[model samples]
Target: MTKIRALSEADLPAVGEIYAHYVTATAATFDETPPGLQEWRAKAEGIARAGLPFLVAEVDGEVAGYAYVAQYRPKPAYRHTLEDTIYLAPGRTGRGLGRLLLGELIAKLSGTRARTLVAVIADSGDPASARLHTAFGFEEAGRLKAVGFKHGRWIDTVLLQLDLTK
Candidate 1:
């Protein structure tokens, strides 16, 4: 059975493995180099310490995915906005885990200082991600063409936002 729960500090190594796959296998993320496991752990720890939601999907003792929300910007004006990120294990895509995580995150974030959640997806045939966000009532707010470069090509970014206050 798959269980979803808060990500403890010890879960970062597994989370890093899931993130590493994207650096080499796909352009889902714009990160060209996967950080070391220690760095990744610290990142996760910081998110958790900030009172933000960082969750993991564990299936029978193995972490299948992780998701979290980060501050949209460093400005005080953006305090009520957050950007979401989700990464699944290499072979764990298409299992509806992303939906589960996103849904849980929305519920948790809605009660916090964040009033809006944004997902900036790489717009290159990534319908699964778009569909997941849409299922959570996130609407397409904007699209920036050629704003990101990965895998030797320019990739567009689709901005999807969910208004948690309403």
Candidate 2:
């Protein structure tokens, strides 16, 4: 059985590895290089310090995927908006884990002061992500054409938003 819970310091290595796969092997993320364990720990700590939600999905005590929300922008005007990031292990997609992770993350955020949740998807071809967000009531907000270049091609970012006020 898979379980969702708050991220822990022990999960950093697995989380970093899961994210490294996407960073190096896919356009799911535009990062050219993956951060080390220390970087992941520091980032997790910072997010926790900011009182945001950072979650992980564990299957039989193994980290299968993770998700988190961060301030959409550093400016005070954007305080009520948050951006989500979710990633699953290389072989973990299409198995309902994405939805589980994202669902739990969204539930945790609902009680917060955030009024909007945004998902900045890297590729339109990533239907699973689009579907996951859509399943959770996120609507397409906008699309930026060829805004990112990765894997020798220009990539478009699809922006989706969910109103938390409702």
Candidate 3:
């Protein structure tokens, strides 16, 4: 069975590996360089300090994926808004696990002060992500044109938003 749970400090290594795939292999994340262990832990620490939700999906006994919400910005006025991030291990995509992880995180975030949620996806042919977000009531906000470049080409970012207060 695949279960979703809050990510603990011990999960940071697995989470970092999943994130490193995007950092080194694709445009899913805009980060051009993958951070080291300490840097990644610091990222996790920042989320914990903000009282935000950080989650992971375990299938059987292995970490299959990770997801979390980070402060959209550092300013106080942006406290009510949080950005979503979901990363699945290689060979683990298209299994519907991403949707499950994201669903749980959104539900958990609803109980917090975060009233708005956003997903900035970089893939142009990513239908699974769009479908999952739309089914969960995340509207298509807009797409930024050529805001990033990865894999030797310009990439556009598709923005999706969900209003948790509704």
Candidate 4:
């Protein structure tokens, strides 16, 4: 059975490993280099300190995926808007883990002051991510063409948003 819960500091290593796979092997993230443990821990701590949700999905005591929400922008005017990030382990896709993690994150955000949730998918080829966001009520907001170059190919970012006030 898979379970979703708050991300703990002890989970950072596995979380970092899961993310490193995407950073190095896929266009899911535009990060050219995988962040180190210290950097990853700091990011998680900062997000938690800001009173946001950082979640993880564990299968039989192993971290299979993780998700979190962060302020859409640092400006005060954007306080009510949060952006989401979700990642699953390399062999963990197509098993509904991403959906579970994201669904729970969205549910948790609904109880907070955040009024909007944004998902900035890094590549147009990622239809599964787009479909997952859409299934959770996120709509296509815009698309930025060739906004990133990774692995010798130009990539497009698709923006999707979900209104929590509804």
Candidate 5:
């Protein structure tokens, strides 16, 4: 069974481990190095302070994935816009876990102060992330070509957006 809940301090290590794999093996994220606990701590704190959620997915009691949103930009004028991020443990994709996490995220944020939820998907030749986001009603807002360099090649980013007010 899969469960979704608020992320806790105990889950940060697992979260880091999950993200590290992507950093080293794929361009799913632009981060070249896995952030330390302090960075993770700061991230959680920042999201919490913004009155948003840092959520985790537990599969049979194991921290299998996490999802969260942060302000799309630092300006107060953009406070109502957030960018969504979701990641799963190695060998944990294609089993509907991303759907669960994203569904819960959208459900939780609907009709709130968040007027928009954005997804910045790295175009690493894998369409999984884009497919997943579009399946959730996220529309293609834009794309930036060659904005990220990883795994010995240039990478583009596909921007998708969901209107929370809808």
Candidate 6:
């Protein structure tokens, strides 16, 4: 069985590992280097300071994925807007885990003050992530072409937004 729960202190290592896979193996994130546990801890701390939710998904006993949202920008004017992020463990895709995490993440965010949720998806020749966001009512807002270069190529990013006010 799969379970979704609040991120715990012990979960930091797993979270860092999950994100590292994308940093090193995919264009899903622009980070050329994997962030260490310290960075992940800082992020979790910052998210806590902002009164937001950070969650992890467990399949049986191992962490299978994670999903979280952060302020889209630091400006006070953008406080009501957030950016969504989701990543599954290696070999965990196409198994309904992404949808599970996203569904719970949205449910958790619905009670917050945020009005807009944005997704910045790297166009790494895969539409799965974009399709996942759209399936949850996110509409394509814009696209930036060749903005990120990695793996010997340039990547475009697709922006999708969902209105939480509705």
- For residues 55-77, what per-residue lDDT tens digits would candidate 5 score against the true structure? 99999989999999899999999
2 or 3: which has the higher TM-score? 2
Off-target runs (Cα >4 Å) in candidate 1 are: none
Q: Which pairs of residues collide in candidate 4?
A: none
lDDT of each: 0.89, 0.92, 0.86, 0.92, 0.92, 0.92
- Summing lDDT over every window of 10 consecutive residues in candidate 1, give the lowest-scoring window: 41-50
User: Which scores greater on lDDT, model 3 or model 5?
Assistant: 5
RMSD of 2: 0.9
Worst lDDT run of 10 residues, candidate 2, spans 123-132
| Model 5 regions more than 4 Å off | none
Which stretches in model 6 have alpha-carbon errors above 4 Å? none
Q: Superposing all C-alpha atoms, what RMSD in Å does each candidate have to the true structure?
A: 1.1, 0.9, 1.3, 0.9, 0.8, 0.8
- In the range 1-166, model 4's lDDT, one tens digit per residue, is 8899999889999999999999999988999899999998899989988999999999999999999999998999999999999999988999999899988988887668999999999874769999899988899999999999999999999999999999
Q: Show the colliding residue pairs in model 5.
A: none
lDDT of 4 at 61: 97
**Higher-lDDT candidate among 3 and 6?**
6
Q: lDDT of candidate 6?
A: 0.92
lDDT of model number 3:
0.86
Clashing pairs in 6: none
TM-score of 5: 0.97
True-structure lDDT of candidate 2: 0.92
